[model samples]
Target: MRLIVKIMLLFPVLLYSQSNFEKAEKLFSQEKYALAKPIFENVIKENPNHLKALEYLGDIEGMNKSWDSAMFYYGKLKQLNPKEANYYYKYGGCLGMKAKDCNKFKALGMISDIKSSFEKAIQLNPNHIEARWALIELYLQLPGIVGGSERKAQKYANELLKISPVDGYLAKGHIAEYFERYKDAEKNYTKAIAIGGSKTTYQKLADLYKNKMNQPQRAKLVLETYQDKTKS
Candidate 1:
């Protein structure tokens, strides 16, 4: 029958796609991006809307600091899946990174789009932590002549506190450190270490001691304490 012939012909193509995708996924997982990229490209060529393949390619480009390429893929993903928060987040992140190297006027022009993208991510998912963190940093760093506001930054920090206590303390500490309020930073970082005790918290406190406060001895002591704890 004609139907039987169509099924027979199509099965091989589907099988080939699946097998190739699996192999590409394995390479990607192993961090062999160069090897994986071409295969994923082929897969996307055959199936132009392949989500995972597109995401992998976007991630590879992001790792290589090819922001425009990453934005192209992520932009496609946003169009394909508009409600997906992470796609918007990645797109915004790519734009932010690209803006960093541009002329000040160009970077300023990019701010609205960057802010909207991250805001869209948060609007899509209210509990999105990374989007909130991005907003906090954006508000903190932008000059008041534009849109910067400590109040806006603190608002997100406060939201972070409600969602995650560790991040809350860390955010407050970051603001304090930015203002050269070393003792306040130490207080918040100390609380963060007590609650989380992760390497990130430890390193943050250590870096603060050494770089900001210029207390190398205290930094050394903190790192030494962390190493001893890890060994035990």
Candidate 2:
């Protein structure tokens, strides 16, 4: 009789937990994170295997920049669903964000995790542009074993370039710059500028010639052309 009474008492708590989970899902879809987090937490407390709740709560924590909490939730979710591509990717992104808080001081772990996550995402969906872009940027920024390698960076860049003319120019220019192939860089930069002129491309090329390559005269010529075009 006592056991039956205890079970009956627990029924409303279970119902309430499930109801809160549904409400949380609705709120989360509507971008009401502030309202959804507590309900998700309640659901997790009641039923720890709530995989979607755990994943979304971790994502919310990441979006809020609550790194430690995000890591905690993602870690839990990963244990439950280790093979899920999104779980790995989001976990890597959270680590990347946390690394940024330290201004690259803790970048090694972040880079490793990011690389792993991107690899997993690509395996899951070979055509995922976001993961491909992530890998491209990672290799481009630190092309060596310490972070990445020039050859690998060039490979990814070339792959991305094949998809579109403008992206090709951008990728080739980055690879050229990485290898100190200044002439190639200049040519690709020019092509990129001609196809789609952005102030950033102008600035990058100008700085490269002026500072890295010790060609201030060439940099000045570029600035002059830019001014002329802008005036026109």
Candidate 3:
């Protein structure tokens, strides 16, 4: 009889938590993060292992650019669900953002952890496109003295091609630009434009024309075209 009474008492609390979570989720969906955060915090307070609340908190913190707080929530999520690729990816991304603003020594110390997190995310889910892209950029931007490798970047670009041709071309274009292969960069960027010309691709092309090719006239034309396209 006592156990039955305890079960009855617990049911209402569970229902209340579910209701609050649903309300918080609705707020979050509407991008009312400031309002939703406290509700999620309340839910987490009531149920420390509320996975959805934890994930949402991490996302909210990340969107707000509170990297350390985002990392804390994502790190908790990672501990709770280590097998989730998204958790590791977000965690690594938060770490990367934090490293960018930190001191050089601290940033250097974070490099291996950032790399491993992204690599682990990919290992867990090979089709994780964002993780692959992050890995590619990490390889491209880092010096060869560290773990950076143009060959690795190329390899990942090829992999991205298998997943998304447009992204692959963009990655190749970026790598080419990085190495001052202006002609190759222009070619790849052009290919990306031909495939699916986004505003970003147009901007990239315009920047290349202005900065690399010394063709301000062509860059201005490109920008004018972009404005025309976007306005319509």
For each candidate, the alpha-carbon lDDT, in order, equals 0.92, 0.78, 0.92
How would you encode candidate 3's per-residue C-alpha lDDT over 47-98 as one tens digit per residue?
9999999999999999999999999999999899899999999999999989
Candidate 1 residue-wise lDDT, 1-232, digit = tens:
9999999998998888878899999999999999999999989978899998999999999999999999999999999999999999999999998988799999999999999999999899888899888988888889999999889888988888888889999999998888799999999999999999899899999999999999999999999988998999
Native-referenced Cα lDDT, model 1: 0.92
Give the C-alpha miss distance for residue 203 in model 1, angstroms.
0.6
Misplaced by over 4 Å in model 2 are 1-15, 103-105, 143-145, 149-151, 157-232
What TM-score would every model get versus the actual structure?
Answer: 0.94, 0.61, 0.87
lDDT of 2 by residue, 117-210 (tens): 7788767765455565666667777636666766676666666666555556777787787779988988888887887677756766787799
Where model 1 places Cα greater than 4 Å from the true spot, the runs are: none
Clashing residue pairs found in predicted model 2: 143-148, 143-149, 144-148, 144-149
TM-score for candidate 3, residues paired by index:
0.87
Better of 1 and 2 by TM-score: 1
Candidate 3 Cα lDDT to native: 0.92
